[model samples]
Target: MEELTAKKDFTDIYTQESPYEYLKETRRLQYRIPDSTKPLYLSLAEQLYNKLHKPVNVLDLGSSYGINSALMKYNLTMSQLDDFFLKEKELTKEQARQFFQKK
Candidate 1:
């Protein structure tokens, strides 16, 4: 009723537009740099990995594009990911062919 209507605007994520809208739309990707916090997250993941042993798995709730999983599984760096998905490089036929060929 009136109480519910008077509640704060907690559901509106669009109140402040996203800064990485272009990256999200064009590349179908979302970016969130963990920066100094990466080590902490990695350390926690390592602990969990050790507890579970080989074939460690992680469930990143808000992970954009699951970059943390990639980092944990493949040891890929953020710089490498950035280089791999440069905005200037359009998807080519050969690239598309090779992508599907690997599997």
Candidate 2:
């Protein structure tokens, strides 16, 4: 526990008093995703899409408000994305489990 609480560097998760707090929070609220993961996700998505030569499906964990899903759809040329999302929003708990599980 003591080791976990010790401060290491600016990027360390345990560094609560870092000056990057506002910048981090701003990004989290804007995209509903962490700014730190921007490069990783973008690079992977592009690479995977290119490899498959088709649209890539991503399973966004902790998908609060489904904002990431919306953003992903925006990157694709699909018809009626809102209709698809509306159907997903109406899913029951069991249905939701199946939906995410298939991802």
Candidate 3:
């Protein structure tokens, strides 16, 4: 009972928008996709591709940053995402808008 209550109390923040609403001003709540789970997600994507026999359109519900969408659509690894979105190249607002528009 005590462990269940503790878990519930810890997860109370998910019941509201305050956690994600602060992203603009504070990156304190960044999503560091666990390396261990990356392979699992990638394997699942491959399985889906094999099962579908065509392009797979996946909707990662409640994904605020679209990380999973990019993974499912592009079959990318977390390192690739870190490189594309955070490293490798930096773009301004206009460049980012144009980049997405081209896609």
Candidate 4:
């Protein structure tokens, strides 16, 4: 019972907002996609892509800073990944939209 209470107290700090809201700020701290999982994720993506026979617009809820987005895209499309690299290379640090637009 004491342990439960302690857990609740810890949870309350972030529960003022929904967990998803807190996640927007803290997900990177607690959640990480291990490198070993990449191959599994890629295999799953390949299976789904082959089954559907088309590109899928995947909405990754609670994604931390788009790391999952990057991973999923890497699995799904090589051409797109190449294009993204090309675009990123052309952008200066100040022109990098990911950091600038978030704020």
Q: Please report the candidate that would top TM-score against the real structure.
A: 1
Q: Which tens-of-lDDT digit does each residue in 64-93 have in candidate 2? A: 334355445444211232333334434455
Model 2 worst lDDT run, 10 consecutive residues: 76-85
Best by lDDT: 1
lDDT of 3 by residue, 61-95 (tens): 76445556655555555555454444323345575
TM-score comparison, 1 vs 4, better candidate: 1
Q: Where is model 4 poorest over a 10-residue stretch in terms of lDDT?
A: 1-10
Candidate 3, residue 64: Cα displacement in angstroms equals 1.2
Which residue pairs collide in model 1, if any? Answer: none
Q: For candidate 4, lDDT tens digit of each residue in 32-92?
A: 4433465776687778989999975666665433445655554423233333433443445
Task: List lDDT for all candidates, in order.
Answer: 0.50, 0.46, 0.49, 0.45
The clash numbers for all candidates, in the given order, read 0, 0, 0, 0
Give the clashing residue pairs of candidate 3, or none. none
Q: Which stretches of candidate 1 lie over 4 Å from their true place?
A: 1-32, 52-54, 87-89, 92-103
Across 12-94, the per-residue lDDT of candidate 1 in tens digits comes to 42232331333333234333454445777788878887888875556876655555655555565554545444534465557
TM-score of each: 0.47, 0.34, 0.43, 0.39
In candidate 4, the residue pairs with backbone N, CA or C atoms under 3 Å apart (3 or more residues apart, or in different chains) clash, namely none
Model 1 Cα shift for residue 17 (angstroms): 20
- Model 4 residue runs over 4 Å out of place are 1-34, 74-103
